[model samples]
Target: MTQAQNPFNVVFVLFDNVTQLNFTGPAQFLCRMPGAKVHVAAASLDPVMTDVGFGIMPTVTFEDCPQSDLLCVPGGLGVAPALSDIQLIDFVGQQASDAQWITSVCTGAFILGQAGLLQGRRATTHWGFTSLLPMVGAVHEDARTVFDGNIVTAGGVTSGIDFALTIVAHLHGEDVARSLQLNFEYDPAPPFAGGTPATSPQHIVQAMQSRFYDDRAAEMEKALRG
Candidate 1:
């Protein structure tokens, strides 16, 4: 077998206004792991809205969430509000305490930072929030995926796919990861080279910042300060 048949429990924290791809990408890979049980958990088993205007039904509640070998937290606009959510924060803290692998994607790293899990650790998040990591006691690294010990963090939305494969390789094997990559047809050849700020035109970057980052940074700053 490419992967060992050991039982594995993986839990993903679901919240309102989450970026669907952040969780979905990683989940797509993790769900295929042999003997792996994946759970989408929230404070309660209710439907949660996404930033992109869709709803997802959490499969389990925090109260019944099993001890996870891997715990994933995804990020979006909702993360600002969640900073003040003691229940959510507490749950993340508790889960991270025992999870063999603590991971996050995009702004999800901020949530983990607020949970006090990123203190003095090298981590990364969506490019927009790179500078903000220091406020939460994390040293930001600009990379697609950053792994420090048992804590792994991914860059913006799409990076979750790479992050998951990294974890899969860690737990399973390199062969298993390559097989899954092929199964998912993970090849990427974007029509445009504007995904990152460095490659994008200045006007495009400014436009995106004006539309999404400005207000988000302000609200997030306020939430973290409070």
Candidate 2:
């Protein structure tokens, strides 16, 4: 298809146990871009649940997904299972081979790594899992949004909003992004000053680590090796 005639396709990889906001946040902005057509694709047509109480149904199946201009993966507790799905990994690898951009929010970067897409790429993930990047050949960078060529990885859940705005600014221009931000009223005046490990109390960080990510590194290593 001619460049002008071709639609800008943005495909989101949807699976069970995802953090819904990680997918929904970016998608809200991405779909607003000019000529952008958004899709949620999964291994099958079944409904998928989020780590939270809700569920979503995939609009497309991997077997029939169109080649996407941008491919996005979302992360949550579900990523561990996604990492073990060889079909999903191969599909991600195939899509990444030709996609203009491969992006992820939160632990979604791990999915990209499992797809063999992060080799030597500078990437980032949720703060707690950033260390796991090196195991999959990615150079870990601590930032809200990281761009290493065609790969853009966002840190944590809320960062997905920032990641989307960044992508839109780069692809569609700052004016478009700014206008969209205004439309969304994207100003943030967070109530607490302890969003990051550096800002949060050591005890709080430790408690979080102990609760959510104590064994994640080892688990990821095993998943990657398998």
Writing each residue's lDDT as its tens digit, candidate 1 over 1-226 gives 4966666989999899999999999999999987789999998887989989989999999999988899999999899999999999999999999999999999999999999999999999988888899989999888999999999999999999999999889888999999999999999999999888998999999998899898888888889999
Cα error, residue 51 of model 1, in Å, equals: 1.2
TM per candidate: 0.96, 0.95
RMSD of each: 2.4, 1.9
lDDT: which candidate is best?
Answer: 1
Query: Per-residue error at 96 for model 2, in Å?
Result: 0.9
Local error of candidate 2 at 2, Å? 12
RMSD versus native structure for model 1: 2.4
| lDDT of the structure predicted as candidate 2 | 0.92
Off by over 4 Å in 1: 1-6
